[model samples]
Target: MFPIFNIHNVLLLVLFIISALIFDNFRHVNLEVIKSFLLENIQYIFIFVCQFILWYKTGKTEKAISALSDDIYKLHKTFQTETEKKEKAISALSDDIYRTLETEIKKIKTDILTLGETFKTDAKKAEKDISIFKDDVSKMCETSQNETKKIEKEIKNEIKQIRETFQIKIKTIEKYISILNVNINQIRETFQTGTKKFEKDISALKNDISKIRESGQKHSSQAGSNLSLTTNRISTIQNSGYSDTETLRSDFIALVDQRSKRETRGYFTPMLHALTEEISLSFS
Candidate 1:
């Protein structure tokens, strides 16, 4: 009743044929024929099953291969994107570092140039100041030399004046000494004249005393004749001699006091020496 071309119908027909053949040949055929036929049928069935399984598995494998390829392509895209971003960041950082270094180098160059100019200016100022200092020192030295010369000239003038004053003092002292010598000689002559006159008066008094003694011895009866008159005359002569001696002493003392007052001033040593010599000569 089924179609013979259909797979189910063919499987049922083959099973029925196998059952009929088993039933018919089971008694007649030997065990060897039965085994041969079963082996042949089993081999054909095994081959058909293997072919069917392989066909279905091949389709599944192809679908899995396509999905795996898609996943690999997506992973490759992500990795490329991440690598590009990292490379860009690294390049930007490198550029910033290069720019900063350039700025720093420029600043350093400018600072060096400024410092060099300042140093040059300072050196020029120092040279000018040193020159001014040298000029001032030279001026001071010249002024000092001129001042010293003026001082020396003043000292020389003072010394000359002092020498002239000393010479004047010496001349004055010489004049005083000469005046003292003349006065001393005059006093000496006057003293000698007074001494000689006193000696003569003393001699006359001695003669008169001898004469009075002789007249008294010879003329005892005429005593009042010239006795009192001779006595008065002798007394008068003695008074005159004493007054002259006092006058001579007073004159000598007054002359010495006058010379001392006039000549001694503050220069007494030489004057005292000359006066001592004159006094010694007068005394001798």
Candidate 2:
């Protein structure tokens, strides 16, 4: 068997022997004679048995004595000694464990304290950052509100001024309309008179031009005999520049006619609108 089984068997044998001895000693409860005889040697036998049993049980010291009193004293001494030794060893072990536990607890406490301090610092920084952010946001909101109010005030003022100016411009346009109505009446009368005069002048000029063209061409064709007329025609064209003067007059009249026609045909509306708009915008 293993050591554990061997040790258990030995313990069992010692217990059996103790049981047998106790039984033998207690048998015949009424025998006073046997009790006295065994009394003198009883301590010895019991000490021997106790020593043997104790040795088998736990390897304790033997309690050898001349008397029961001596045996008891020796057992007491052995018990005190063994108990003291165990107590000393246990005390040492407890002190070691206590010291180790104390060190670990202190280390843990220090680590916890460091973490607490770090957390505190970070919390303070977070609080400060939040406060700053709040302040910045508040300031931005205030500035935005102030700017909005300022812009609103400016816009209101601008709108009021625009309304006033628009009213003034309307009045000014009404005055110009009155003046334009008068001018339009005058222009209508002038157009009637100018139309007749322009038509008469154009008719006269056309007749003159036709006559000159006819005379000039006929002179060129009869170059052999009408040398004098040809000479006069060329001379008139060069000497005083009469042909150039006539062409200039004709071009002027043509320009006038084109202007009149352009106006009559509503081609001058764009110019009239631009002029009126320019006058109206002068207020702004």
Quote the lDDT for 14 in model 2: 81
lDDT of each: 0.74, 0.64
lDDT of 2 by residue, 53-118 (tens): 766545322222235568788999999999999999999999999999999999999999999999
Top candidate, metric TM-score = 1
Worst 10 residues of 2 by lDDT: 57-66
Count of residue pairs whose backbone atoms collide, per candidate: 0, 0
Model 1 residue 215 CA deviation (Å) reads: 3.9
Please provide, for model 1 over 98-129, each residue's C-alpha lDDT reduced to its tens digit, 9 standing for 90 to 100: 99999999999999999999999999999999
**RMSD of each predicted structure:** 28.2, 23.0
Cα error, candidate 2, residue 282 (Å) = 37
Checking candidate 2 for backbone clashes, the offending pairs are: none
